[model samples]
Target: MMISVLVSPAPPEGIAPTFGWGTFAAWDSDLYRNIVINGYSYDFSRNEYLVAFFPLLPLLIKAVMFLGLPFEIAGFLINNLAFLGAVLLVYNWVKELYSIKAARWATAVLVWCPYSLFGTVIYTEGLFLLFSTAALRAFQKKQHFWAAIWGALATATRLPGLAIMFTFLIVSWREKRSLIAYIASLCSGGGLFLYSLYCGMKFGEPLAFLKAQKAWQPAQDFWGQDWLKMFMQVLVGSRNWKAGKIVDPLHIIIVLLICLGAYLLWRSHLKLGQNKTQFGYCILAIILWLLAGSPLINTVTILGGVYLIWHFRAQLNLLATYGFCSFGIIFSSGRATSAERYTYAIISVSIALGLLLEQYPRWGYPVLILFGFLLASLAVRFSQQLWAG
Candidate 1:
């Protein structure tokens, strides 16, 4: 549907954009394709943006290219394959926590989300989902070794992979698990740890990846004032006569929905379920929010994850923790460039909606239909190069 919508408006006369091996290589896919072909270069004068991307997906693309396929073809195939694996893992994980119906619904939500088209491109969302879901499920099933393996791969895939470690450690400590289990879970960061060492040797800074992100000049206020102020500015932009592009109705709707979602999740339980662990995460999220100095969109995604955690704390503690940790890690950096894609990667909103649909089939179907409509609209906007995010 999206491709068809965008395909009609052919390039204007003489304006020829290189459509790399089908349109799947749109936008950020070009970066991954270049990474696959040229490999990483430390020369800041040329390709420093490469450092913002993790190495695992490009490495996987290179391995796939060994089969003599075109780079774009290999990249698309890799993403689609990983997406299939991710959907299946999500289904199984939700099934373990809930029911088959809920699992099916959750898988639908995961696979067809508005921002999920990235999973079909040469992006890390698909591969990251495969690794993150596998690690989360393995940990839930008491398969610590497998969890560590997947978590390590996930960490190598995206920075947010560190969320798995936080989830693992917190859950382990809460359950009074073995020290060995906690240590094993900590191994999830092994890939990132090794990469940092390699970076230090090559680029003379173990934190070179962190330094590379400076190209984006992500907004930051360690005191939290800038973060909250930006959020409020966006929230009540209508009141500001000269707010300009910052006053987006979509953002306001998103903020209201996030607040409403958190309230709903809180009321999902009869008694307030606030505890030290939840409070600690709340503080962590606030601190991260303040330090991140990210835009309003990214903050909303984090709040969405917090709402998911608050809502499902009783039904499934593991899912809530996973959601919170994932949101925290993503928001920690403070860039809102691809906040929607990042939120979909964590996927707690989809999971929650899926279960809600299963629980209330009557209204749930209607809501799902409405959501589908919204998703289609967003897809169309994205296909047309509009600001769907």
Candidate 2:
């Protein structure tokens, strides 16, 4: 069950884990390098100060290291805990408004996700998902302040946190709870802004991380690159600093399953018509995801199975939208093969899955298995990276 298995015996060849997975593995060396040397936390020093990875994830990892747990154990504890939180929130949110079946399926899809495993490996997605869902749940209950505050915390975990702000405003206006909603929205929106300011001071320039990213990889407008290139990266593998050897094309198979999901979404949307408020939540969540870009797309695109089974069924296409967006991202990816390259591979799998859904319909699953093999090949690639750590 533990993804950190490699760290135990002999980490394979070139693998380089931060802190050697000793007491500091969870505290990514890169993350702590920024924090410990200087009191200034966040990435104003290196890149886009406004919209890079959040500080909460780094801070959390540090806390684990500080607790004296080995980095692997610390990372495992934090990430799995975050995963549990994500699962709990999704279940409760679905159960609160819709049927138990919806909640159960949502949680299952999320928990079983191959991609979600990344979160369980000291990644940020699970923490972000947990906060995002909690924010949404709060909004649904008309708990404006709580929703905004939680949503803000979620945003601190990932850039898509803004979706909470957008949805809260929309729902508040719809329900005529304008004042409370406005207040909550401000609080939620302020969370990231405040963090950004702190990061700016630490880095010498505000939004330093933002500036650095532009310099690192300048993306043209309409950045999503061609679909084929995305496939090659996955089929072969991508070489990125962030994710190391990430050629996992397994998600391509998941994307293939969206066909039935889209049909279900259309039918369900038509069937539910105007009465489905939960669908609105999905819409808002999707919108937030689109804006967050990289991490969000990575999280959303590999969800072929889950989307196929969404309870509101009609909202299924909402799940499919990530594929289209991923097309745009592949375009943005440049000649340099970085973590973004593997990301393109993901984007490639996404939109391709959308096409397969429309065309083969029944043939989707087996094809996914094939693509998954391609992704699996990358496993060998990273053994070096992990061991070297």
Candidate 3:
């Protein structure tokens, strides 16, 4: 993060950096800060609605600010610390279930993935990952009390945390676990239930959070035009997709060539070795991403995640169920915005990838190298107040 800040070009005229932290507090960061300082408010006239944001991070920042820290410092401290805790939890949990090598690779993937930029910034990704991972790990260990506590905190942090709660309930039913398991599963949603109560009292609408989401993302029918545009953009490049014509023939050509190369690589039985082939694919993927950008990423993360979960379902068990549940919710949202970041936060994807990488350590190295490059680029983009993830 420091390197990203240091390498960032100066802000353009009429633009200001966020306290020399390069604009880590841009976009949703500002909204979170507003929620912290001014508290929640709703004003359609001004197009302001704080209820769209969950209260956990802002509430934590407010608590930290009571000690005289500014919003930026408090937010940075909280998010980074929470991210570190999440890394530790993921590492230990993976090590317990798999191998130490897999655990190390998993933590590395979590840190180096480009979307991880959100974890270090003033977003719920870090806090949500920490709480959700804790809850999932505790449940795996049969620590019902801690699972419920962490699960409640997770749900309060982000809506996807509900997937963790549902995973518990489904796994308990399938396994015929004790009544305490069912109780804990239900209690896991306590945070969301409390938030709903607050919304009912404050706005006279218990589902105001869901309503406010429409402000950011207008409702659309299932598999609507927006979804089609996103998927097409991934294949043909954004310009060509939006223009409804081949604005850049080279883009589609490159995409097709990359796809062909991937298929050939999969079919080859050459003696080139797995390391070289994996590295080659990594380079091709980087080129593909460069052509298609975030739409491609969003497509790959969601679709690829589903494939990973299904392929590893038996080994992953509860984690696989959580991945499916998370995807189900994301699909219902009917928008592609932040899909990569949201999918990455699910933890199951990371663990699944880590387990896959564990068997092919050579392949893991190039993947991690690619991830590091993208991670640095994303950090610089975020620091420059540009859209990332």
Among these predicted structures, which one has the highest TM-score? Answer: 3
Q: What local distance difference test score does each model get?
A: 0.70, 0.49, 0.85
Deviation (Å) of 15 in candidate 1:
8.0
- Model 2 C-alpha lDDT per residue in residues 108-218, reported as the tens digit of each score: 445443344355555566676667667666766777778877878876765445545665665566567868777896777666787678766666666654554455455
Candidate 2 at 134: error in angstroms? Answer: 0.6
**Candidate 1 error regions (>4 Å):** 1-7, 10-20, 43-47, 218-302, 377-389
Candidate 3 pairs with clashing backbones: none
* Predicted candidate 1 versus true structure: per-residue lDDT over 183-265, tens digit per residue: 87889888788778878887788877777776545456663544555566645443442455554565456556656655665
Worst 10 residues of 1 by lDDT: 10-19
- Against the true structure, what is each candidate's TM-score? 0.77, 0.58, 0.93
Show where candidate 3 strays beyond 4 Å: 1-7, 10-22, 218-224, 263-268, 271-280
* Cα deviation of 336, candidate 2, in Å: 13
Give lDDT: candidate 2, residue 108.
43
Cα miss at 115, model 2 (Å)? Answer: 0.8
Ranking by TM-score: 3, 1, 2
lDDT of prediction 3? 0.85
**Using alpha carbons, what is the TM-score of model 2?**
0.58
Judged by lDDT, which candidate is best? 3
